[model samples]
Target: MQYIYAMMFALEEINNSSTLLPGVKLGHHIHDSCSLPAWALQAALSLVGGDMPSCNSAAKYEEEKGIGASKGDQPVPLIIGGCNSVTAQIVSRLLVPLSLPLVSYTASTPSLSDKQQFPNFFRTMASDVYQARAIAQLAIKFKWTWVGAVVANNDYGLMALKVFQEGIQRAGVCLAFVETLQRENIVSDARRAALAIQASTAKVILIVAWYTDVMELFLQLDKLNVTDRQFLASEAWSTSSDLRQSTFSHKVASGVLGVAIRSSTLPGFDTYIHNLNPLLRPNDHFLKEFWEKEFGCSPGIATASPFASLPPCNGTESLWAVNNLFTDTSQLRVTYNVYLAVYAAAHALHSLLFCPDVNSSPGHNITCSFTNQIKPIELMEQLSKVNVTTPQGEAFNFQGADITGKYDLVNWQSSPEGQVQLVLIGLVNGFDLHLNESAIQWSTGSSQVPVSICSEACPSGTRMATRKGEPICCFDCIPCADGEISNTTGSTQCVHCPSEFWSNAERTACIPRQLDFLSFNETLGITLTAVAVSGVTVTIAVFVVFLYYRQTPMVRANNSELSFLLLLSIKLCFLCSLVFIGRPSAWSCRFQQAAFGISFVLCVSCLQVKTIVVLAAFRSARPGAEALMRWFGPGQQRGSVCFFTSIQVSHYFDNLSFTPDSVHIQWLSEVYTYYISY
Candidate 1:
């Protein structure tokens, strides 16, 4: 979103900066394209001019009009625009014949580079052809031998497809297939597309559509259970989430592979935009808000067409520099250096206008001022040769016959966790056409893995493999299991293991969990036996005390306790706790702990009641007046304690008796107990 702001800011700055060149001081006007494709066409044609005139017999005609007089029919002769590629084509065709200079700031379709057709047209950013070659070169470096292409049927798509095809052919790779999809076609088509590509045996497929389309295509790929294929995308892939996360994540999470020009993360980009627009904010919001407030809509590539030629270099930071340089410059900078195109054409026309050439009216000085003498198409050939250097230090010379400029390539692979590991494959000097043409292997490592990236020997357990007489594919390494992690990029060994599968944190290997031993061990099993015997002793001691005090009417009436209630309640709760602790099954492991907590709480409550009753009987003189305490008496509390103790004592045995399947009731009668009394 911020990208739009920087683009608008570039146009604003170029339109605002005054050129110190001593001539007509540059005055600037702005249009709000609203970033719409249709509006972009309007802004381009409107700013650069919709029509041009014939350059034939221009000299005698200029001489009759005096200084700067030829543009009398249409006074403003300079032009720049057609931010959309279609509009640029229209404007380029319109201006090419008469040689009116036209420049586009953002329309980067490869067709505009046609020297014969768009002789007068120029652009600051690279064309799609350059981007295509860069991506194809990246694919070659990855050792991919075959590729598929998915493109729209538009001019941008066609141009991108042509250049990509050329690049792949030049790399000695095969085109597996070419499929076309519409902007609106969804998963059904994507499924068919992937299936068809799979038939081609292509490892990587390139998409020329929007990122959302790419994401949808991949989601459908997952549904097809065909995630083995790789992917390559254009500059349009930057805003894509799948690509960004895939770089450092294991590929299994999402199958995606590609090379793309990510905008440079230089801090100066924001500063550049802020200097142009003081109320700095996010790129899109600022652009939409400012353009809407000023021009009743948001601004876009079309609105800035007049000054497209000023920002020569379209780097990550150049947008900001553009906005600051041409804010109020000379007429040339204001309209994509159209005046300079005039500056160059006026000089070229010197032979025709003033020199003793076959057509010239000799010694007649037609005013060099291009305000009117030059037609929009007259400068087409000459403008192509001009090198625009903005005050912000942005420079561009679009003389390259083929695409490909400065593009970085990174080799990527996926790991088990669904993360992509982007290994720095190597930086290719794509613009270095000399090395590539100098020899088939002139590059240090051809296009894929440059020989200069690394020279160290690969560690053991991994091997080096190359693809199709070119770049290395990957360092093949064996992966360790779930308990381990890899800390280094090329490490042969796995790192620390997590605790879920280990007795200790150290993860040499996994060990089996030990089942219950209390069922067989003498010390543990016998100790439990002794504890049960102690419970019996406690029961006997309480019963003896009850008999010793039988003469007391309080003791006789109170009764020691409800033996049946104690046995029934304790047995039921103890049985449930035993079922919980006996097995490690999911049901038992999670639910048993909760059941035990409730049972223990109840047991403790009963024990507490017994102690309280005992104390109340010892202290109170009027026992009946104490209500439940005096009326029911201290004996109830004591019996509650016995009830609780009985429950707690049985729990110890229950816990120790746990096994992998004690609650295996189907086998319980046959295996868990033998010669049962009950």
Candidate 2:
């Protein structure tokens, strides 16, 4: 209805302009399509004269015209709209064979771009391809991986669904379910769609339907108390006044995010609506119906007896009391399309009539001559090349059969007073999509963006474990393994640490491993160092005691030299343990094991020599070992000790020559026992 008003408004502007098509007046017979394809077809049939008489053929019609040829018969050169895709498709099919140009204000299905099927079809609205791509980008940008979809059972819904499905999948977003709402059974279908939405876990829903379809579905959603889901509306009815004006729209679609056809504010459209009266537009024909609906009254009835219950309009009723959605000039996207559609037709006709030889002229040798004829085919050819700028400075042009227009990103937000209205949040043009995230309101009524993922995001230090038979978004968070790390949230795999490194407690990063040899500050190292020092002191005390008693007869009989060597070797053995007190280094690795080996050898040798001396002394007393006693002495015991010490030192030097220069320091302390055994 807004489109019709815009079209009529443009026609009036053009008719009143003395500079445009001078002395020629443009008039139209308007039809109410009632949002039905059959009604649209009926409207098209009425324009083509309904089997009355065969009008001039295309060739005969071109030979005669009021503007450029001898005045002669001609059919209506163009038809201007059924405002939706399905209706446009029906009307295009009915009027294409008759060679009538069908200029649509809002029909935007991409299939209509095929010139072969719709050669006479043209539109002032951008194709659904742009809108679908824009919507897919929106979901991807916000990381809304899982969402539901509800579409009407018609060409617009099915085509938009297919387009958006392909686009979103390419961007890695998945739909929870694609449900359909049947206009024929709106109540049942809406209920079923609402139940599907409520049952699924998706918090976002994409609605690809007309304004009326959206209204019915939202009404059902409100009744079901399903108001928490965010809705993504297609360009078809994204900024529809009908939806905005609906009573249940606020409850159901409070936080709708959608792509709307771009529009500039039209000046004075509000004043134009407010000043309308049946008395002024007596010839409008539909004026009576408008008066009846707006004022709730009859127009022609003079007496109150016929319609006593209703208020009879005095033709001075103010439309300012009505809702601003139907009166405001803001967000006139669809109305702008209608305005452009009329201009496209008027410009094409102007080119055919008066400016045939201008830059928009067709083919070779054609010139603007008053003798050149005007026809529907010629007007269509001109419309395909029509390029002009709107009064608001918007570029108006056609790319093949599709118009190039912008899509504004809009969000339905609640004002401080709790009234819901659309706020411009972004813009989408060509392939670029930008959004202002902070300005958007979510259905959750929280400051944060509403989450629509199938599962919560895996935090850092964990990797995702995808659930079987579920969407990729549905996953479990598993901590990284002992020697691995995951530093990013939602990481698919954890990385293993290097050989000499270990994962931190949180598993978010790797750190070099601590050196493992005994250190003096540790409990075991302190205990061992204390014991080793005490043993050394005790051995020194023993050596001193033995020296102090050397002059005594029992000490003199015990072989003092052997006793001194044994005490010194025991002291060296206790000191060897001190080498293991600090972090193992090259010097400690070589010295700790060699010192222990040599000390053990010297102690054993001293014990062996003492054993021989004792046996000889006892046997000699029995009178059979006199020769054995003569050979055993302190000098022999010293020689024995020296021999064992030399052997151990030689073995240590030989093993050290064959060992690698740098050993793995972690294993050095444990190799001390092996050195002794070897």
Candidate closest to the true structure, highest lDDT: 2
Instruction: Give the distance in Å from residue 26's predicted Cα in candidate 1 to where it truly belongs.
Output: 4.5
Residue 594, candidate 2: Cα error in Å is 21
Per-residue alpha-carbon lDDT of candidate 1 for residues 1-678, written as tens digits (9 for 90 to 100): 233333333333433433312222222223445435465445445445533333211110100010121333333344434545666777667756566565554456877777777766665445776667777765676556566788765687788989877886765466666777665566666677767865655556677765556666666655555655455555555324454463222221233334444223322445544454312332333343343343333333333333333433222332333443223221111123222222333333332223233455553344344445545444444444445554445454556312234443434444467544443333334443211222221112233332212113334323333434433322344554445644444454665444334332333445554465344245665555566556655656665666677677866555345332343334445444344333366456434543544344454455456555566766667655467464555465565555656665565446544443443442344222322321
Quote the lDDT for 92 in model 1.
65
Model 2 residue pairs with clashes = 68-370
Error of 2 at 277 (Å): 3.5
Overall lDDT per candidate, in order of appearance: 0.46, 0.74
RMSD value for candidate 1:
25.5
Measured on C-alpha atoms, candidate 2 has an lDDT of 0.74
What residue runs in model 1 are displaced by over 4 Å at the alpha carbon? Answer: 1-39, 48-84, 94-100, 106-109, 127-129, 167-172, 184-188, 197-201, 238-269, 275-374, 378-382, 388-395, 400-404, 410-678
Error of 2 at 504 (Å): 2.7
Q: By summed lDDT, which 10 consecutive residues of candidate 1 come out lowest? A: 57-66
